[model samples]
Target: MQALFILSVWTSLVALGCLAPFVLALAYVWVDLFRPHDVAPALGQLFPFSLTTAVLTLGAYVLVDRRDPPRLGLLTALLIIWAGWITLTTTWALYPTAAWAKWDWAFKTILFSTLLPFFFRSRIQIEAALLVILCCIASNVVCFAIKSVLASGGYGRPLGLIQINAGWGGEGSTLGTYAFACLPLVAFLQRHSIVAPSRGWLRWVYFAAPVIAVIGAFGTFARAALVACVVWAALLWWRSRHKFMVAIMLVAGAAAVVPLMGDAWKARISTSFAPRQDESANTRLLVWEWTIGLANQYPAGAGFNGYLGNRFVTQDEWGEDNVQEGRAFHSIYFEVLGEHGWVGLAIFLATFAVFFLNMRSVRRAARARPELEWIGDLARALSHGVLIFMAGAAFVGIAFYPLHYYLLALAVSTSAALHRATLSSADRAPQESLADLAVGHNAARLPAWRQRAGQTKASI
Candidate 1:
């Protein structure tokens, strides 16, 4: 009990540190949830990520590898060396101001790198990571719900209630981007859980939480978020055709009552796209065209920072300071082209191509390899999340965002680790018994989800 409490507290605090709007700002959850968590050692504190932990894990890995070394091959070497190049290239981006503008990316990267590796080291670590993510989602939802009700005319103004946490990341709606990303995984796990059938409150929470979240996301008045929700719903439908149909009917029924909200909802929705007709759209179009023209002018492009610092000068468009830092091409593809030219754009696309292909392959591998099943599921979900976000948001920013790169690294490392463990297990399996402890765990866990999943009423 003490240990569990300590662990809960530890995780709750970490969850708050990495994610805002989490319930940690409240005190009672500490006593109620994290008693065992309280005593648990800091995950970062132990498990060797500091200069100290790195040296120790390295030493331990070397010792273990010496005895049971998995053969390293050309592909492994290339991937590691490539990641090193990426890290070096990313570090070479010397403009502190530019990096600062995208600090959200940096923090996300740091979070992924600092925490994700623990999953590969142990099943406990994998479960812990998932738990933290889920808890963070649940906690934040509860907190934001309470605060929104208070700020509005009670819950009466559900459509009007919005969280404006400027400190976390983006203001209003952009802050909800991460939550939108997490919804699919939450939906998936909730539907499959053994408790799905038995837990009445959870059933309601699961059914309503994502809907409420989407509404809350809509309330942020962020068109980007609305677009994200649509895209994810599409993907979820693609994942299950039957559920897609059910979703369509439900959404259609909800649509029938939209007139009741009066013109306010319609006005807000219309206002989001209205920007497409105004100076903002013109500005974006101008930047995109100018950036592309500059790319054609310079073979190596205008140089990485030139997009912000010199694109205007190089293209001879500057008379006054229009932008604060002179950053150009808000779009990632255009940014790459403007800064690094066609070659840079090529490299960037190739990198994403590699990440995408690797993600697909890993997802395939996860199902094929018993040892890798859990990690595979996680990788697939994360990969899908990344795909969903990048598809909708690639226009907004570049890959300098640390979370994206950090997840790629985590994916690569864990993929290698999973492959190694699976091969080893397979080699020894024929000589001994075909299964072990984890097989049972997987069996116990899989059916619960499968059974619930079987009952799913597919809809779009």
Candidate 2:
């Protein structure tokens, strides 16, 4: 039910905004321009029957509104620097125009990353954005369950009676990654709830979300996610021996279920379940070996987004030992190494390294500082989940693809907000009502944020 409450509030607002088209689009223009994170006037809790809000948002993001900028970080700075080199290299490459085109395409992600911080200025913005994301995921689960229930004549099939829509990723690996991202948010929120818990239905949603998400991962049938969970357990054990012992017993019980898996399950699991026995794994190894030779040819390596270029589409052997008959190496790790080379891969991995160090440091600090235990836990889970996702995702997804992009952006937003919160207790401003702020957090010539915090009666 906790997931329900959080999901409801966020979705209800989104639904409301969607009801009115033109008017809200105008309002969002004002919202994004005056304050990127500001909400348009509310239409009660009812979802109106219009498609205006989303249309307006897309319009705003594209033609009208501009997002705020991000601060400097060693890893992030390197990303921008790499982007420049890629663009420059593309200009002189065999297919200069294609190079520039892809380079420009990649910039959308950079643009997305760079501007999020400026608009999410206040703590409320951070909290609301996160709530919106969690709610969206929860809402999807509820919808999927409803669809399954209706389809199954009430109880649904063991495989879930829900039919997959054309775009439903339903991949076990996809769901696993999504769950990994979401659980940290859920756990963090639960640990810090101002109105702790009493018996409530919403608590059911909270408990159920993690379960459904994990189960859905099995539905998606990506063995990588399952492998990730297993490895994750081992890491948790290494990090905390006591937790490891308890988890070991639980994992053993789960292992017993292997016999229950259907043939479809066995077929998918066979790939990673026994990599040496799998033909696909063997092929990937061949592809990876050839790709390594390509990376060695260019010391700085190919620029980001350089793989599968005009020539790659034609298999032009972009300096590799041999070009395979296949498209990409398929694996994310190889994809990054193949495209970005040693230099690009290093910059990319460096970001994960910082994330690892930050999480480890926060976990240590959390242990010593009881006062910050909740926050420290949130930070730890957020960082840990992200790190694991990237490591797993690198093999599963081309690093920094759409799925990775959104996840990383979420991390950057969370990390930046947490850091800001620590430095400026002034952010209690979010606790205030909108009427109190009178303007958005970005409104120029404002009084100190701490003073703004004094105006609102709201908490949590």
Candidate 3:
């Protein structure tokens, strides 16, 4: 894998030169998520992929792009504020050493999040990023499936039993959360490709992506993922123009898979309703309650990565499960509350609030432009994915996850680009073909305004 990373780096530099750093940065983002460590161990540890790529991308953007600097959106501003607040709170953190380390990791995540909008200038660039991330996810899914097959039918259990990492690769619930968040993007791309026509191979790959993603989510055996996937699928089906066909496909897919699911999967899902019987559910509830207690006690905040160690000492007095190592904040809301206190939590929520609002504006702007119909579709898909993250994060510890912020950055860029497109088109309306541009007619027609205006005056 190290050799592959080396080859990839060399190839990018040779083929793309100035643009290579930014491309590698985006590649790093995807590779980091997939974490193909088994295939490439050195790639996992040797390179600081995201940070290095981000610095290189920033340099390239400044020197070569020659365009206006990317505008920082409301979400980005809030994130900056939130990061600063987290850093400030680290000074008084219960565990200062751990706090600083946690702060560094988080700073890196926010750094790349801030850079993405600047890098993604056009609709094609945005689509490329989405496709790349989806393909990375698909690769992870395929790997998990391969692992499960080799392990001889353990797909019904927590994936961690076979693959014991965390984040995208390890934790079943985390992987499930990722799959759920990405399902909308895959579906949107697939639908758009079919309607507008794209490369045949690319369209087929998009078409199969959602299915592979669904399989990946199911393999996780994560209840939150299951719920989120079901909700995401419904939203996609409703938003799709071919509702009946989508419905039939969905039903047929379910029919083929249902009989194959074992009792273990059924039992695992059933635990969602009967939480009393589920040890994991009980532990999660205990963790959430402990987090709430911690928030109330330490109104200022526990600081970054101050949970487990502090919990060990404080849990005996305040927690229900005094002996158990309290899991890190399971819910994003609770996570923020516990780690950052009221002010941090408020900023965190506000960031997403502004992000969703921006997406709405993007969709509205796209609705106004016939040439940018895909922008409207993408905006909706992004919104749905955001909703899924918000919902799924109730069960997953994704308060600091890069994917959510990455999507927010894209939303910011999409809205900004669409706004610019609308303004530019309006500015050019007097010279462009007015009738063809109006009422959602063909956008390819050239301007005939001068001749038409002259003929109209003559007729009058």
Candidate 4:
């Protein structure tokens, strides 16, 4: 049934793409996020779903969609360089098989993200793209939340759609991080979304989404999610006009949710504060340390899956030497440093920095313009989402994930929209001023003309 439904949706969207090319773009994002093939193996055997969607999306863009090239800003440039650097590093990667496997999808993610701003130029297009992403993510989030509420989810449990506890969606920590990161976007969409209808019970679904995302994040029992929640709250409070009310609500919400958390969840989260006490946390610390040493030894980096070569020793609680080999970096920063080297890490950081600046630029440009307020608000939401993701990424190795790249693309699109709007307004300003001046000049002659007509009427 699931397979039939998914196929129906995919076919419908593909057909719709002929009339509206942006629909194809949305279809691609849907396939990427939902991974319908993974959900049903029978579907996978039929054809390559992801590759087909990508090809269709690109074809639609070239053949049907209007080509409005995005401004090649610092962010885009940085992303391009970053992509190139990672590819170059892959050539020297110690683990060639693993490196190439990662590079295949990673490069595609970068390329698509770079092209996203071009496809979504207008407010409606941009909002629709975000809505599609949120909905896809919510599918997993809703399921995870329901299971958590019913079973009181535990650490290492697979609460999402996929049973395997690996990759972005299946992994608890990464899923939890994504859940928190999406809160800001959810809030933005609820208020300003043009694509979503304002009337009916559908509107309330937006309200429920954030709550479900929170539950799902808690359900994962990930310390990274806890940290992301804190950062998300702080960013929300900072952006909110009613800081006091937001603070109160934050505190009250936390109070309400805390009691619902299981003992296992509390214990796992507590380990974050005292890293040495927990074996996992201790291992992460060791991995990060090893990454730093590796960075110094090989400044050029060991490329993707470089951690496979990592070997470290640690003393157990019993004071016995234990050897740990082939452990993952577990940190995005270390993952990049280990895989792509210092140069790639620099490019990665610069790209995000540029994204933040772009959002700031949009906010400042849209500040006083009431018509552009939605753009400003969206920019804030994207920035907050990015900030939360960055906080989460400190603990999770998601440097090359599609989520962050999507957020970055949205930021760029918002900034680009702001610039185009500003320029159009500027072009109209002179014409409007001249029309006002001509109206005033005509009004100034009207009284004398009326007096002359009155004198002529009296003489007649």
Model 3 TM-score, all chains together: 0.83
lDDT of 4 by residue, 1-460 (tens): 9889999999998998888888888888888888788767688789798899889888888877757667888888888888899999999998999999999999999989888887889989998899888878887778789999998887788777777787677787888889888888888878888778655887788777768878998898888888888998898888789999999999999999988896788888889889998878998998998898888887888889999987778788898988989999888999999998888788888888888888888888889999998999999899889889999889989888898898888888888888898889999999999998986677677888886776698799
Clashing residue pairs for model 4:
none
Top model by TM-score, which number? 4
- Residue 366 shift from truth in candidate 3, angstroms: 1.6
Each model's Cα RMSD: 12.3, 12.5, 6.1, 3.8
Comparing 3 and 4 by TM-score, which wins?
4
TM-score for each predicted model, relative to the true structure: 0.60, 0.63, 0.83, 0.94
Badly placed stretches (over 4 Å) of model 3 are: 5-24, 35-39, 149-163, 191-198, 241-252, 309-322, 430-460
| Residue 349 accuracy (lDDT) in model 4 | 86
Stretches of candidate 1 above 4 Å error? 1-115, 134-168, 191-205, 241-244, 253-265, 271-276, 297-329, 335-341, 366-376, 413-417, 433-460
Residue-wise C-alpha lDDT for candidate 1, range 309-379, written one tens digit per residue? 53332222344444323545656678667655676676666665776677677777777767566566666
Please write out the lDDT profile of model 3 over residues 14-73, one tens digit for every residue.
246354435654665664555444335566477555555556666777777647446776
Please, what is the whole-model Cα lDDT of each candidate in the order they appear?
0.49, 0.50, 0.70, 0.86
